[model samples]
Target: MSVSPTSQGQAAIFIPTPNYLFSASVNLGTPLAPIPLLEGGQRIVEPITGGTIGGPGFQATIEGGLAAPIVLNSGDGTKTQLAFIYAYGHAQDGSPFYLEESGIGGGPAQTTRIIMNVGGKFQALQKMYILAQPKVNEAKTLASVECYSVPTPV
Candidate 1:
């Protein structure tokens, strides 16, 4: 017996493949303390030659292998300017893991937040990437990540 051309089993079947999805949602609000302005350290919305604010910097990490344009959401406080630096390291596969530098050969996209003040709930986005660094002879991975922004003049 032959299946009919118009039958559900033989209607010139066309199975479409699933498309690739790239993107992630990261929660950055984890009660972060003010990053102290240190000597010789670059900060957001502040000149590199200015004195340190003498506070603690915002620190957090994200899951590696996230597609470009990672969304960083933090419900804490507000300020001006933000920076996300991707630390280079090795992956579990022993392959070098690195996030392309901003503006480097079509590097990963980035988005900055314009916080108004500090001491309250706030949210922001960080599109940059933080390379994955798997521990030697270990399965866990780590990446040193930090966020910075300046408060509006009172």
Candidate 2:
């Protein structure tokens, strides 16, 4: 059998604009001892003791048990890069949420700045929606969150 290249259907691509969900400042407690990785990377787990979330109609404190494990990759020797983290929190009404963020950040260890894409899921209630049908039924929003990190006083 022989194969041939042929023009096919048009590709449909949609770029979603990230709706501003909220701005949160996370407080990462003192990091635990770094666990050496096999690939010359180090895994560090920081405790997310507390924080705050603010948006259009929601505000809440970030719950504990949220551990952010950042894997630092030794890159060009000038600076170490790459970090990945997963965190969880709750809204003022006790509704829960989780966030996953990954990006490259490098500088001094204590003042390193991380720019990462944060995304998470949350349940929506009647108050959060105008339509009655969606408000009453099981509703949720998968949000693309924008987040930045700053060293907080412990």
Candidate 3:
């Protein structure tokens, strides 16, 4: 599938191939606090304690980050978070990296784009199209984060 964001009659935009990047189970610490509002909705601020990610030619350790997701209630016993993450880590070879993701948390099949930065040998990541899939646990203490890259032409 492809995306067509046209002005008048422009052609469809390019769709890159799904390039697997990495997958990891992100560990979380307790949230600082919940700022409740909107009649049962709240904003959650959780800390990303640690994790690991590896795929293809890279393997990295998750250092720390912040998770700030706005929880919205449907009034029907359902709630979902408008989630955002700022994660950082280091490659096994001592290369530092950072990743940012924005998507829904506590929902099924939710995927969103990833903005990443890398140093050392993995610097090519800055020029690639990336995506992330994250699933939060019931206790809100863990997230399984998987990232993918869409291969674009040079």
Candidate 4:
């Protein structure tokens, strides 16, 4: 997707700020993409042919654990503060993973949220997908964090 045009007198290409940022590999456990949710917070696995309802959501991770503070910036020196909600765990793929919690934790804000500590390596390698909902804009995007870790012998 195209990022918001940079201020005049600036470069022509405005690098879209990544709404979702991650520190490490945390499997999403499943190929759960385009997770469908209808009005009134009802989950739907089937596709909705047509309907104007809520927007999309995302998944992300902070290296080690999010038990600490997360910094958000506008990519450039611009300090348009942003907020985020994150979770950690493994996907249903039988590997370790993490994800953002539902509700307010993932809501918008001007400051950063103190995430909970998520530690542990999955028994097997897994791929991760991070979905982000930009607060300032309507368009949303998905990012994947792939992990290829080999166990170290004791």
After superposition, the stretches of candidate 1 with alpha carbons farther than 4 Å from their true spots are 1-21, 38-79, 85-154
What would you estimate as the lDDT of candidate 3? 0.80
Q: 57-135 in candidate 3: lDDT tens per residue?
A: 4589999998887888786877787878888999877989998888775565567677878878888888877878887
**Model 3, which residues run further than 4 Å from truth?**
1-15, 37-40, 75-77, 105-109, 152-154
Residue range 25-93, candidate 2, lDDT tens digits: 566666678888787767776666666767763466666533334555555565554545455667666
The number of the candidate with the highest TM-score is 3
- Candidates 3 and 4, the one with greater TM-score: 3
Best by lDDT: 3
TM-score of each: 0.21, 0.52, 0.79, 0.21
**lDDT of each residue in 34-73, candidate 1, tens digit only:** 3445432223221111111111322222233221222222
Error of 1 at 102 (Å): 6.0
TM-score of candidate 3 on Cα atoms, chains taken together: 0.79
Error of 3 at 6 (Å): 18
Model 4 lDDT per residue over 1-154, tens place: 3535667678656443333333232222222233233422322121111111111222322332221112223446343322333544432233334434222222342222222333333222222222323231122222223212222222
Candidate 2 wrongly placed segments (more than 4 Å): 1-12, 78-82, 100-154
